[model samples]
Target: MAIVKLSATERRRASAFFTCLILALCAWIAITLSNSYDYQVKEVLVFKNSPQKRAFHPLQSDTVTATVKGNGWQMLFSKMNEQNRIIKVDLSKLDSEAYVVVSTQLNAINAEKAVDNEIIAIAPDTLYFDFTNRSDRKVPVQLVKSVNYQQQFTQSGNIVIKPAYVRIIGPSNVIDKIKFWRTDQLTLKNINEDVNTEVNLQAPDEGNVSIYPKTVQVSIPVDEFTEKTIELPVKLVGNVDFYNVKVFPQKVKVTFTTSLNRYADIDEEFFEAQADLNLWRAYGYSSLPVKVTRLPDYCKIVNIEPHNIDFIVKK
Candidate 1:
């Protein structure tokens, strides 16, 4: 048996080829290691139970802890772009005593290499939350504006409300600040007759509160008035001793104003004028006691022309 030996040149060429292959392999491993080691901690999403129901607010504290794994260069880039470290958690399905598992991944890495093994897991597996029912309450009425009638016309009666208060329900924090609902408009314009209408209650412009009874019925009375003059006839009451006594302008006239709806019911018979006879007895006047009769029930006297007249007596 005989073994064939390679020439010196052939052996050297083979060795050089083997050495180049080893160097290339080493370079490839180094590059892979460098790329895989570049990564950063982006953000840690915490699922905390909010004090309110069905409401979400941004967490103010930026102190988030997360375990991130990625290429070294990618991690450095995440540090530069704070958004790359954000962790998002859905709150729509939150419930009392219920926890959810949140899986996060790296984003916004400029590296050409795809992130093969990049993931972050929250400790304790899931976030637990507790939900509660909101409290409800009723608040008193608050008058925000005022109404004034035209001249010669006035508000004759009190303003009436069917339900003076409103019901409010919501989270405790929001319910506490609500005082009362208001009405934007309550008018008393050109109303010759009684008014009965419904008014909507306005909610607070800025708040989380909600009102149950959003509307109320209001009743207002408007009256039309006009001045008038009428004569009131004097009448004698009780017998008077015989004497020569003259009563001047034996009739008195009164003037007043009232609503047009009630104007037709007004007349001279509604005025009453009376002078006490007993008072005149002190003055030695036998026929001084004069009384006016036939006064209307629904009328008031604004002024009396010739309010009183002197009586002359001769015996």
Candidate 2:
């Protein structure tokens, strides 16, 4: 090579060009290293606090979302198998009140590939535990619906339930709110015979609690029958001016329909069947009075078919 001398200005220009080239090469190397091995978000770890000690209500689950950081290569690999990236925290380590930071080492992951990880904060960060045991109670059953007989009918005897009570268990604060569990409302307005129904149990005002038996079987004993005519004691009311006027058929017949259970109790002493003889009084007659009598106390009036009767009287 021939020795070439450079002027001061040209030498400075050449030095600047070399410095620029070296800086560019160092920048390229640094960028390549950063893209290849630098730390970045990868997989996230999540956990629930005090799962064994606290009672979770319905729809409560322990799983939570976590945000992870790692290298681009590691993040790409984790994203390919996203389902496997979830870290499950061991509940056995939970005790007392403390912030449990998820350990990246404990996670079932490639340590050489993982760059960074974080725990996602969730509601109820701290959990409280009471070691006291609880006792279950059997609540008495109640009727939720109105018990009514058909029109002109009456109910008799005791209403019965297959199982008189249901069992309930929960925290005392929750269970104490419940008084009596009742079955769904039943309609008996048109029912004339024994009714058997499956009724759902009521929760009352208890929160986050449930009954052992959600439903109950109820049996309503009923009967339907027609009324029979019976003679009753007669009492005269409202005197008439019909002397020597004798009324015929002093006891009038009255009929109705009711349940058989109540039919046995029916008698002539329950109702008032009467006849008016005042017409005879206007015909110059005296000592004539209307005769009214009561039927049996045990009988119920379903319908008074042809309730009135004609009475023949002579003066």
Candidate 3:
């Protein structure tokens, strides 16, 4: 290629021509985008004002393609807003009819949509439903948790759930088999103290099923735990012959873990140790096994001194 240098006047003229071309392009775009045109947007369909006497399940998908009449700029913005938009169709007519006309509710649907975008039509214009008898039942709420506690600290008491049950109203055939509803995952990390919070219930899988009071209050009792030891007399059990049996080492130290706050509350009275004498008669064993049968709530037995006891039988 040969290098050619242009005069200053020629360079200015070339620059002016290119700028005019760019201006014309932008003007054309503005003109084209200002005109009204019809466009399409897909929206999720939800039914409201449902018929109370009957439960229904839609035979088709929850999505419907909507034809919208708007200017090009409106189309651009409507499309951007389309991602989270949902169209609520009225199901009141389903009380007597088996199908619903989505277009009949276009005015109501457009009311919730962008003001400039008018919904003119919807594909699959008629929605069919499968109907069944309506029913309701109460089911317990099960909590799902993923908790990581700090070292030497953990949940010390029972977890309490407020409104432990929820009433589910839905198709009889579907709701009859549901045993319980699950709450959303309760997640915690490095928790060293009590938890008092609210968790939403998991969304019902069946669209026809509705749960009342979607959230439940959750309380998790947490604390730091330390070991405590106490001595208690071992009571004899399974003495079928009513014979007086003497057990060596009448008392044993019970070592267990308890939350710091409840350490003093749990003592000899809260614990009971028992030795079953049936082993001597059942299997000719010389010693009886000792077990701490009763323990205070939230306490774990760590060690029982003298797991076995020597016994002497007297008639």
Candidate 4:
């Protein structure tokens, strides 16, 4: 193929067409860069540089409307870059409750995307905060756990927690309301043996509040149990001297379940079966209900054999 050379008149026309296109693009950009525009960024983050010794709690809104004035291009760029709208204030200068007047400083805000544009104004130019003395408190820790035991298994003794108390420090307003710190929810299913584990504690929602020793050791003792039955002599209760009371079948089978660890420690003497003497006098009933008034804490009563026993009273 051969190239087609254009005439002088044709070349001039082509050049003028290209020149006009370039001129139009440049004019558009120039206009966009020179025209001023207003932009409002909602929820502009107001970071606080608080003093290490004093904790400053912002009782009011921490966000502000950053209304900035700049060229159309800069405004549009800032709108797209949400991070550039954030500004930080120093709270170390505060002595007590005060209103801090904050002015937008281009150089200090968003140093990475520093722009030459000017800040028209910032809404709620003043920020208010309450500064209180900071101190630490020791609060007891509570475990939030659910244990579903397998058949014939029961928990024995108390649940032990290492470092039962934690240190919490924050503003007095918040710390005073805190009675105890709680551990994260822990659930064990079909557990048949002792459980020893470390669990994390829930963190305080307040930004200024902090807790030391975020985790604690939890130990739960579990043991297998079996039902045991023993015959016990019944004793009369209530005004026994008024009437001579005697109960037929003086012995009652006490059916109970006990953890294996404490099975040997339990004895028939530890149990006290009793029959109410008042019932014999009130309704003059021939039989009275037998109850095991006292038993070991580790033992769970399954049934009181021969629930009712015959009784005879003689005046």
Candidate 5:
């Protein structure tokens, strides 16, 4: 076949014709994408205004498919977004009924979502929940923390929590299972002074439990630490029979580092120095190993004199 080459004028006309065709194709795509269309999207359900009289548990998973009506532009963007939409369902009517009709709450739900993306309907449009006996229990609060203290500064005494126990009200089964609630982690770095603040407890999980006074006041005593020494008489332990046990140097010097606030509060009575007699009887040891069985809180032992003591047993 012979090749057909166009003249300069013919080439220009062909180029213009192809450009118009391309522009027309682009216009069609723009018009189509700008039109509104109905689409489906997934939404996570969150129940609010729970009935006060009944303790309830959802019968189905919180996710539901929603029919949405919006422009193609928004429809395209929704697919690209990795996050699923969330719809808050009002459960106030559960006081009189066991099921919640989500359609009735559409006006309120729409207010929570994007204005342009109108939700048409939802699959499994009605939500059902199981009811149980509502009960309230008072549970202790445990503090979770990560602390770094300044040099020579540390906690002086026991931490005080105002309202140490929080009242939890929910299903009896859930309340009975919870013995204690933990507060959110409190982080402190380079702390030199006392800490007094309100820390929130971990939020109730799954909406099955509700906590009252969600936050508690935490007071931590902080003070500069200093070394102190005290002399205390050593006592004998593990000698069941009344045997006369004499330990040499009847007393030992207890040197420790304590916070300044607790310096005057702590004394020899706060600690018990004991020599285990079992060391001699069971192992035939020449000396008895001395141990400090009890020490006050927030006090660090620096050194205990006569870690091993020479003793005589008179039976």
Candidate 6:
């Protein structure tokens, strides 16, 4: 072992420096352990085990300020390492009307990792809530979506939704005003094949509302459409007080586009071509435009041959 000798003055200086460091460390620890502070831990309130036949709605506030009493070290570490601090609120067998939670009840609320700290005060010291059992109703669902189809393709059948209705429970004033439930927007482009998708429904913007089965399956039937042409008889419409009235080429060709599934259903009876006598004379034109008023919803008119018809009238 080798020993290096130092002067007495150097040794005293070194000893004094270490002694001061140790004293300062001990004083800091003592001060930290003796001091207590109010730590406001912002924690969300969690509701559990709601009463049967009685539904609870929104709470007045979700987050609460829990003022706790603990030493400086305890409070600082808690604030730094705090995960989700929740105050559990059990609503089983609760009342049906609006109620307020007192401070004494808050003392009973369970909070994890807080046993070392004493909860001295809670800001806004009261929790307000509402509950109801008869404010529920069933309403139909409305699908809201934007869909663009590929060229030459069209919808062949209705847009179908499974579980077409939803059950909603909330305040009577709010639920009664909601006649239909709308789904979230689902956008699809260049869609040529059938669409089968599950979509989420929209939740009400207002508070204290609850909805059951918030999603639905949507099926949109689509297919490639074909063109078809048929000949139909043109009939005169509107009252005719004229002495004589006659139309040339009483038959007209009707052209339209429709899905193949509906091709067989398309017939002359499904269409009507009429020339309004009153409009024909009112316009005083050489020919009257033929108007096709009725057609199957699944079909779109492509063109109508002899779009105008020549007529002769005598009065």
Candidate 6: clashing residue pairs, number: 0
Cα deviation at 226, candidate 1, in Å, is 6.7
lDDT, candidate 4, 15-50, per-residue tens: 999999999999998897889888776645455565
Tens-place lDDT digits, model 6, residues 58-163 = 6567777888778887776775655646677656536654555536665566444455776677666666666654488999989999999999997877789988
Q: How do all the candidates rank in terms of TM-score, highest first?
A: 3, 5, 6, 4, 2, 1
Candidate 2 has its poorest 10 consecutive residues by lDDT at 123-132
The whole-model C-alpha lDDT of candidate 3 against the native structure comes to 0.90
Best by lDDT: 3
Q: TM-score for every candidate vs. truth?
A: 0.33, 0.36, 0.85, 0.54, 0.82, 0.64
Higher-TM-score candidate of 4 and 6: 6
Model 3: which ten-residue window has the lowest total lDDT? 76-85
**Model 1 per-residue lDDT tens digits across residues 1-315:** 898788999999999999999999998866775675523343546333333454222323323555556765555555565644445555444433344445422232213113343555434335554333566778876544355656666444566776888887665666677776677577555444566887778865423345657778887666766777777655433327655656677776677776666677777655667654444655655444344444443344577656565666565
Q: Model 2, 274-302: lDDT tens per residue?
A: 54455444464433333334534334444
- Residue lDDT tens for model 3, 127-196: 9999999998899999999999898888888899999999999999899999999999999999999999
Better of 2 and 4 by lDDT: 4
User: Weakest 10 consecutive residues, lDDT, candidate 6?
Assistant: 93-102
* Ten-residue region with minimum lDDT total, candidate 1: 104-113
Question: How well does candidate 2 score on lDDT at residue 112?
Answer: 32
Please give the lDDT score at residue 250 for candidate 5.
89
